[model samples]
Target: MIHAQTLVDAHLYPNQEAVMADALRALLHDKPQLRIELAIHRYQTEDLSLAQAAHIAGVSFDRMKALLLARNIQLRLGPADADEARKEIAEMERIIARRELP
Candidate 1:
């Protein structure tokens, strides 16, 4: 199999990072389930909200909720504590400032 460095050497991609990004896009396109899995993993392990996971998975918010429920994953509808609430609010503000809200 051709390595990312080989693609870079051939000038097909600007660099290894570009090659990896393209490969990831293609792989995620071909295996759409991977997108959802990745999103779910991030939501479960990271501080991401459900909406963020849905965005990453390219699914509706409700759909992501259902997927999470179907997998028996407990929902974190709102922040569990003051610090988390603050973080969530800060993230929301950042998204709004960037005009990233849908």
Candidate 2:
């Protein structure tokens, strides 16, 4: 934190606010989401359900399902979901290879 006198000195300058904002952005950027997540989990010590965890993370249910699948946790069990997983994998691969690229 800055000294109170420094803030008082910069009271009349718009650029001082911008400088503080840039510094804050730089500070946050240094930590990755995984680091932040682990720290939060360790401190809060709450074993939230996957859906609840996703909501806390500010992501949609579908995105959280994808994240679980990435971590090899099943969203559902049995044959139909296997077919759906194959389809999703194929679609993701196609999209990754072609849809968003030249």
Candidate 3:
């Protein structure tokens, strides 16, 4: 369980307190789909990993992957570094060379 307090300045609204209370109630109880959609959006934007988003959505990794695919959301493992790509290429070349020799 996490405890959080948000300070909102709704002075312009006539019934600020009531509006805020209703909004909070809707967010907490009537909007589970909204939470899942936000989690998926975060994953799509690379703000969260698939695992993190899955945890947020209370789903498995495979389920998250399927959801992303269903939504046409591309899964980014992480940013690819040039050095890492070069190292991977070199390793593959070495493996291929050894196979050719045998």
Candidate 4:
């Protein structure tokens, strides 16, 4: 079977990391629920903001919030300060620009 090394040797991808990234992109595209689960996991463990998680999961902010709530994950609420709030806004803007939300 063709593996990451095989693809790397063929120069189809620059490196194993690129191969893994493409593989993950395809897998997440084909399996959206996994993306949501991954986003939730990152959100909980990686200190990712809700908007960032939503972007990663390919879901809307509200939908992500609901998913977290359904799983009994306590929401983190608003940003701690102005800089964080700005970051959150930037993420939200990116989500909106991508039309990820309703």
Candidate 5:
């Protein structure tokens, strides 16, 4: 991969940060399909929220949902395991008991 410093030194960008940002932006611009695929992967892998993935792909929430549906990927927003649900419920119960005390 071409380094950001190389691009900066070549005068393609004013600074290292700008070069890196512009390179990434250009890559996404050039490969719109890749952006969508990456966003869906991030959402599916739980690396980003649906909204975040949509933003990253420069699309709307509905568009992101459509993409996911097209790929037959399930929408998972909450915990997948019973243990996590129990922990959440326990926290909620503690909060409720505290509120009832005062």
Candidate 6:
């Protein structure tokens, strides 16, 4: 194992190195596949890139994109856009529900 100082001396971004290793470790662990949609959503809202978010969530980039697509979530849209979409859907649902209420 390399010493922290030595790693630092190599002029690497500490957190980046740590997180990357963590992501790889987690992705390789024996376990059920994680829900990539939820992970991507959270990471997007928290300021992570698609690749970075995938790593942060410990999934492959391809897997993350596939999950987003399967869930009908657009990867190009920001979280704020997603929130607006959610609100619009909620309003539409409420209107529909009220129409049936007599």
Q: Which candidate is the best by TM-score?
A: 4
Candidate 1 — what's its lDDT? 0.89
Clashes of 3: 0
Q: For model 1, how does the per-residue alpha-carbon lDDT over 5-34 read when each residue is reduced to its tens digit? A: 999999899999999899999999899799
Residue pairs in steric clash, candidate 6? none
Stretches of candidate 1 exceeding 4 Å from the true structure: 79-102
lDDT of 6 by residue, 1-92 (tens): 65555655677747556756755666646443553544666765755445555654556778777877877766754335777666646755
Instruction: Give each prediction's root-mean-square deviation over alpha carbons.
Output: 3.1, 10.7, 15.3, 2.9, 10.5, 15.6
Q: How close is candidate 1 to the true structure, as a TM-score?
A: 0.75
lDDT (CA) per prediction: 0.89, 0.53, 0.67, 0.90, 0.76, 0.60
Regions of candidate 3 where Cα sits further than 4 Å from its true position = 1-30, 78-102
lDDT of 5 at 11: 87
Q: Considering lDDT, where higher is better, how would the candidates rank from best to worst?
A: 4, 1, 5, 3, 6, 2
* Residue pairs in clash, model 5: none
lDDT of 5 by residue, 3-77 (tens): 888888898889998976887888999999889888887887765556567766878878987888888888755
TM-scores, all candidates, are: 0.75, 0.31, 0.46, 0.85, 0.57, 0.36
Clashing pairs in 3: none
lDDT of 2 by residue, 35-85 (tens): 345433532454334434444444555766676676665454322567766
What's the CA error at residue 12 for candidate 3, in Å? 24
Better of 2 and 3 by TM-score: 3
The clash number for model 2 is 0
Candidate 5 residue runs with Cα over 4 Å from true position: 1-6, 10-18, 77-102
